[model samples]
Each structure stands twice: as structure tokens, then as C-alpha cells.
Target: MTHDPIPARLAALKTTSTPDLKSQWRDLFDTEAPPFNRRYLESRLAYRIQELVYGGLKPETVRRLERLGEELDGGDKRKRGIRADRDRPITGTRLLREWQGVEQIVTVTRDGFEWQGRPYKSLSAIARAITGTRWNGWVFFGLKNHRGRA
Candidate 1:
């Protein structure tokens, strides 16, 4: 009968402690271990062991997964090939619009927008304050269209 090493290795993982897990991480990854907690090491090592036994993902597949993750997480402004928003104003950008014969400006923040030295929950909130009515913030500032085109 053929032998299975996976169960034994997983059992050993449960028996081993945190310090030993770091050793395992180095043995498996062959690099200086990250300062991650025990559970992280255990899970990652389990995946690695299985990957070694069967096969690992293709390099191109891994790159695609990483790019998808970066797109979902709003990383790297110039990674538009990853489908990052093409025309969205960057964080810390200043947007200006004229309403009622007055020029108003808002500054972009990582989480939200700011206007008149005050942090706002959304651009729509700022638009409501400015126009005294409901307005699509992106349309008001021409960042995107009322129909959601840039």
C-alpha cells in the first residue's frame, strides 16, 4: 500500500509549539520566517505541504490572484491594467467646482473627503451641504458622470 505523509505531518504540527513552528516555517519556505502567530504558520505550512505533494499554482495564476487582491484593496494607483479605477481622483487630491457663482473646493482623504477644514463621511454629504439638496457627488464635481461614466 502507498503511504500518506500529510496526516502525520499535520498531527506533528498540532504537537509542535510556536518556537518549533518558526523552525518548520524556515524548513518549508527556506527563508527567514515572518513574525506571524502560530495559527498562521500552521495553516500556511499545511498549504505548502499539500502544494509540494500535489502541485503548486502556476506563476501566472499566482500573479493574477495577487493583482485581483491589489485591485480589491485599492492598491497602487498606476495598476490600471488590474482594473483599478482609471479616472478616480487620488487620495489627498483637491477638487474644485463652481456652484451659485461661488467656487468651492474639497480635498480627498484615504477614507473619505474633507471640505472647509472639516472631515465628512462622504462626498454626497458635502454635495448636499453645498447645494442645499441631493446631488450625486461624483457628478457634481465631474469626477464621474450621472450615468457613472468618467
Candidate 2:
């Protein structure tokens, strides 16, 4: 009888140590593991292992999924929009706002925001630093209106 190694590998994830899981993540993803919880790593690693063995979704399936997404959002990002993660801009986008006669530029990064050569976890933090007062970062950056319009 042929032995299936996939089952054993997956079952091992539950008992694997944090360091081991990270090592496995590096091996499977060819990069460092994200700073997420152990459950997130295990779930992603499980999916990646299965995907590597059985292959990922088909190209036609991918296209169909994309079409479905567009249908849900009216195919126009500016029209219906996909607010999957709040209203954060896409990574690599640069936001410009003039504050007190000086133009403030903030760049969107994969992890967070970058402003003035400093990395910030939230826009509110940057807004606080910029104004030295409590301000809604979204409104401060013009991402949202006073009435909460995106």
C-alpha cells in the first residue's frame, strides 16, 4: 500500500513548536514568516502544503473568481469599491495632504504607513505626531470626510 505523507505532515502542525512552525513557514514560503499568531501560520502552512501537492486553483477558476469579485464591486474600484480592510489604500500608493502650509506625504506599505522616514502601525498615530492633537487619521489625511464618506 502507498503511504500518504501529507496527512502526517499536516497532523504534525498541531504539535509543532513555534520555532519549528516558523522554520516550516520559511521552507514552504521561501521567505520569513509573518508576525501573525501560531494559528494563522499553521492554517496558511496547511493550505500551502495542500496547494503544493494537489495544485492551486485553475486559471479559469481564478478568472471566474475575479469576475465575481468585479461583479460584487461593479468592476470599478472607485465606484463600488472593495473595502476588505477598512478603507486603507492599496500598498505603494502615496497620499498627499497639505498641513499648516507644508505638504505631508504618506506612503502606504504592505505592513503599514511610512511618513518622514518613520514606520507607523496606524494612521492615527501619524496624525497625532503631525498635529500634536487627537485627530481622526482618516479625516486628517482626507481619506474620509467629516460625515464619514470614503
What residue pairs are clashing in model 2?
A: none
TM-scores for candidates 1 onward, in order: 0.46, 0.51
**Predicted structure with the largest lDDT when compared to the true one:** 2
* Clashing residue pairs in candidate 1 (N, C-alpha, C atoms within 3 angstroms): none
Q: Write the per-residue lDDT of candidate 2 for residues 38-111, one digit (tens) a residue.
A: 99999999999999999999999999998997898778867555346867899999989888999999999999
Q: lDDT value for candidate 2?
A: 0.92
The regions of model 1 sitting more than 4 angstroms off are: 1-87
Best by TM-score: 2
Give residue 55's lDDT in candidate 2 (0 to 100). 98
